[model samples]
Target: MQLNWDSTEELRQAIHTYIDFYNNHRIKMGLKRQLWNIVL
Candidate 1:
């Protein structure tokens, strides 16, 4: 995806947002052997 960020601050914010998602809200796997399915 192309981010139409017009300034350095916008790019910084986008990177920070992605970092927060990577740390918190994305996904996880347990020892029970569960799988994730993506539905379009």
Candidate 2:
């Protein structure tokens, strides 16, 4: 995928947002095993 950003800061922020959503909202069966390790 190609990300077109006007500045480095914008690209960084977008990447951070994507990572945050992937970790919190994306689910996997193995996630249950580590449920206690996640705070939210």
Candidate 2: regions farther than 4 A off: 27-40
Candidate 1 collision pairs:
none
Candidate 2 TM-score to native: 0.54
Q: Model 2: per-residue lDDT, tens digit, 1-40?
A: 9768999999899899999888776566458757856855
- TM-score for every candidate vs. truth? 0.52, 0.54
After superposition on all C-alphas, the RMSD of every candidate to the true structure, in Å, is: 7.6, 6.6
Which digits, one per residue and each the tens of the lDDT, describe model 1 over residues 1-40?
Answer: 8668799999999899999878664444332234434321
Poorest lDDT segment (10 consecutive residues) of candidate 1:
31-40
Error of 2 at 13 (Å): 0.2
Distance from true location, Cα of 36 in model 1, Å = 16
